[model samples]
Target: MRVLIAPDKFAGTLTAVEAAQAMATGWLEQAPDDEVVTVPMSDGGPGFVDVLSAALGGELLAVTVTGSLGEPTPATVLLHEGTAYVETSQACGLDLVPPERRDPERATTYGVGELVAAALEAGARRLVLGLGGSGTNDAGAGLLAALGATAQPDGVLASGGAALAEVTALDLAPARARLAGVEILAASDVDNPLLGLRGATNVFGPQKGVAEERRVTLDAALERFADLADRSLADAKGAGAAGGLGYALSLLGGTRVPGIETISAAVGLPDRARAADLVLTGEGSFDFQSAGGKVVSGVASVAGEAIRPCLVLAGQVLVGIREMRTMGVESGYSLVDLVGRERALGAPRDSLVELARRVARTWSR
Candidate 1:
């Protein structure tokens, strides 16, 4: 049997490449005669840069950039020829902040700006910025600040969402000039809008440490900022991603595109999946979000149309079997359930390999 092992990063535990390796190793150990191929995947989140770099033959370039909390941190950007791939999460990810300091209101995207500046200094003619896993709700204001763009006091400038209520004006002249000749691409996987229940503040604010009562305030603030910027933030797909960074990018002449499409094209996933007898895809968690445009769902969508069997092995599987089946996933398994929550969460590598080996043994029979 020809099996394709394509899995996303297991969040805190393993990278997509590492997960694929573990699964491949386990499968090979149980079925030595079977053919297994490994393909790592990401959904334009934290591991996007690494996965894309490995698949696209790009070099990982390390640069010193400010952290989400304004601390000095060493971040990496992927570069190939005149194009640089920047995963904004590297500099502004929630994981970068300590639990006690997880305040989305105070967090900033300055580090992302620093990375972009460094890439531009390196002579990159084009830049693709992946937006996800961010800890800030500055709407890319901090990013512009780092790039020497100042926010107008009367323009829709807000700190987090609550502050948006105070926004009345916007300043983009400096930013426009700075980014004049640069082509900016905002690669995102979400379709959520800028404001409302399904918007950035309402859906993602809580996770970024916004208090329950503060959500509305933040949402309103983002609304005002969107209005002053003269951009139609309402119902704009992907405008909710990265704390309204997508909207900010749109205002800055950045084109928004699906992250999976870009990564798949770069890695040649569609062609490879077509040739495989079985395609395996997964992520840290599989639920409505997975079906809502994540890499695993994207892979499943493509594989389904091609009449290929796709299996999923996630760190945690929250979706019901029926839902996953409808998505064309032949089978779905969770490492957490298979190995117990503690073991799966604590020593994921060993547990995942063992589980994969057992599963492979069953299939071999």
Candidate 2:
């Protein structure tokens, strides 16, 4: 039997490619005679470029950009034909900062803007910007600055969320000029608004180390920046992605699209699933959000359309069995269910291998 294995990054544990490899190892260990095809998937986040590059066969152009804390960071931009693919996480992801050092107040998306500028210099007209895993909450103030929105005179623009308070005026005309003919698409799985409880600051700021006491101030600062930019785009979907990088890109005519849909279509997942005998996909956690424009749901949709059974394996299964079935998933295997949270998080590769072996014995037939 031919098995197609594709999974998203298991967050803090295994990446998409690693997840697929582990599942293949386990499946092949049990059924060595069976064939396994591995394809990793990402919902426009950390592994977006790698996944697309693998599928699209592109030239990877390397450039130096700023990290979240203003250090020189090396990043890759995938150039396929006339389109350029850039993942924000490659430059300013939260993973780049250690847990103790996380400070959204000082984080910046300046590197992301640098990547876009580099892509433009390469003659890219269509920009696919994957917006996730960001460490900043300055509402793209740093990105705007990098794209030529300095604070007037020789004074530099403030670095992070806190400095947005001093952004008395912004000049996006230069950026607009640079991106005049470029088509920007902000790919994001979340549809969070730019400001409010579900907005950038309150929902994502804590993850980037913005203390509870400082959320209001950062939110207010973002509100002020939005007031100066476009106050009406606050409620737009995807506006809150990557800690408000979505809202930032929108300033340059960036439109939002579901991350999973964008990636699936670009990589031809529907066609791949149609030709596969069985489809296996998973993620770090299969929860309520898994059904809402995430990698698992997107994979399941394509598999279902092909009348193929799609099984999900995860670190934890927060969504119920009925709900999982309703999403067209044949079943789900959980590391937490087999072992425990500690083992699941600490040794996910082993647990996943065991789970896949068991699934092959029980479900593979």
In the range 205-228, model 2's lDDT, one tens digit per residue, is: 887888999889989988988888
Task: Mark the regions of model 2 whose C-alpha exceeds 4 Å error after superposition.
Answer: 152-158, 339-343
Clashing pairs in 2: none
lDDT of 2 at 18: 87
TM-score of 1: 0.91
For model 1, residues 184-246, the per-residue Cα lDDT tens digits are 988898888888898887788888889999888777776776677755755678877898788
**C-alpha lDDT values of all predictions:** 0.80, 0.88
The best candidate by TM-score is 2
**Candidate 1 deviant stretches above 4 angstroms:** 153-169, 233-235, 362-365
Worst 10 residues of 1 by lDDT: 154-163
lDDT of 1 at 51: 86
* TM-score of each model, paired residue for residue: 0.91, 0.94
How many residue pairs clash in model 2? 0
